[model samples]
Target: MTMSEPLDPNVARAAKLDTATLSDALDKLGIAGQCYRIKPRDVNFRMTGRAWTLLYGPAGKPCGTVGDYIDDVPPGSIVVLDNGGRDNATVWGDILTEIAHRRGIAGTLIDGVCRDTALCRQLGYPIFSKDHWMRTGKDRVQVEATGVPVNIGDARVAPGDIVRGDADGVLVIPKEHESAVLDTAEAIEVAEEAIRNAVRGGMRLDEARKQFKYHQLQTRQEG
Candidate 1:
């Protein structure tokens, strides 16, 4: 199917995870499925708090720009927008980042380009997007609706799903699957840490890996 094909972004299921546990989960999951943060934004806006999900469109002309969602987002929620991969136009800018941060929004994940990198950097906002651009999304695009399904890489994200991002990248733990995945991922992380200690203490790679069975840990078990 095309990336922009119609899809329902709904909280068909609810997922929950605490901040302290999620860190452990990500550690075990390792760098995966996320957009591999090539270059970081300097904006001082940070996605404070633990885990908050923002469900959106998979493409199909999602309504509202990055700014429009800022007002509606609750504290600690992420602003995930779908702009189809039109890397030529920029959908997010400095003003939106500032507003989102003040509103206590966690961060933003854009399927398109962003503008005002230096401003974003200064504001300390964490943005995961396709590219950075100097152009504004004026006539280029506009939101057709809010709270819809948007394609973020290989996954489908909806409102209330757990979206976790970091220096590695971003991962969407479906609302239905988040709790189980988080639990499994935590155990995997602990085992990996044990392996890390083994390596640091002078054990051989194969020996340490075999002792931990690192290759066998599955963080996300598709149900």
Candidate 2:
């Protein structure tokens, strides 16, 4: 099945690469402006997660949870939280992490603050947050619309967007581009490995670079 169609959780989890591989893939692909992840990091785990975004309002009728929209949400759903761009209230907490872990969830993303930060880290669940705090959001805010388009920092996420997060922040891979990104990422990884090996074998940087034409190769449109 294509990425635009429903993806198997089993397949997604299998597609998850280690942090080293992911970083190397990013480096090869020349994707930048990401890193400096949240504190008390766990570098061991990697997540292959999908977005279930939500907008929010205070005690309103149109609210839900990381679990509500994703209760039966596939095991790899990332639960990307977008509380109307507010970074003050808690959108993720210990219980949420516990729930996610139980359900085989890949991870969580808060484009805002999260409470029980220590618990999340303790469980070794990957959560990308804009900030951390102890404030409760149950009274102040609740989800307004679930599985809708929401903005996380500069990235716009829909229900099925692949949200990959590790010790190096999150990369929003649109559902439309999942196959392209994944395939290109692997290709980049292959080229990067070749370059690294050449560099170690007494080949100078400039000569190897000119010989490989890596820059031109990655930029060329693939049919």
Candidate 3:
């Protein structure tokens, strides 16, 4: 989706759904979106917003700054930093956290690492990343591009793509497929809820599963 396009309402609905259901939807649709090896700093942390992507690369001869882009991020947007999964240097820190929180930015998602996590926890700001470290990215890495497509784990994220994350990790829903993905995910959630209700009402677990066609929830939908 273009940056100027208003976010789809389905994006908000998908945000209410967990990564597992969204992953299932993507699987059913044959889309690759599950980001591997990335996790939330705190399991309780959760974030959902349109992606505002940034690509990072090894610094040049003189090196470059780490986070001058924070001031440009819009509220409710997720800052997606692709650092090629580097764990040694952090692209996020307390200063960025405070500003982002104050500005109402939804959260930060990094394919690399972050630092000064204590402030993040204190402010209840969500941060999903590969890991955390104290070494700053100042002299090691620099922003290669902004408002461009970037990789997070194995998933490709573009500007305005819907980014949803939680304890299970992050998944990017391609802007073009947001509607279909959210529809499938909501259906799956409904079917699973029904199964739980049946089991609670004394139905055999196997019986409930069969009634809900549980095994077919993630099966690829046929044309």
Stretch of 10 with least lDDT, candidate 1: 3-12
- Candidate 1 lands at a TM-score of 0.72
Q: What is the TM-score of each candidate against the true structure?
A: 0.72, 0.76, 0.94
- Tens-place lDDT per residue, model 2, 135-177, is 8787678667777887777667788876666655566666665
lDDT of each: 0.58, 0.64, 0.90
Q: Name the lDDT value of residue 45 in candidate 2.
A: 43
Alpha-carbon runs more than 4 Å astray in model 1: 1-67, 218-223
Q: Given candidate 3, what's the lDDT at residue 173?
A: 96
Better model by lDDT: candidate 1 vs candidate 2: 2
Query: Could you tell me which 10 consecutive residues in candidate 2 have the lowest summed lDDT?
Result: 32-41
Best by TM-score: 3
lDDT string for model 1 (1-223, tens) is: 2211112222111122332345445444552333333223532322322233333323334434433556666666667766666677777888887887676566778777788877667666678777798888765676655666556664566676666555444666666655555666666668778998999999998899889987766443333
Q: Model 3: which residue pairs collide? A: none
RMSD of 2: 5.2
lDDT of the structure predicted as candidate 2: 0.64
How would the candidate models be sorted by TM-score, starting from the highest? 3, 2, 1
In TM-score terms, candidate 3 sits at 0.94
Give each model's clash number. 28, 1, 0
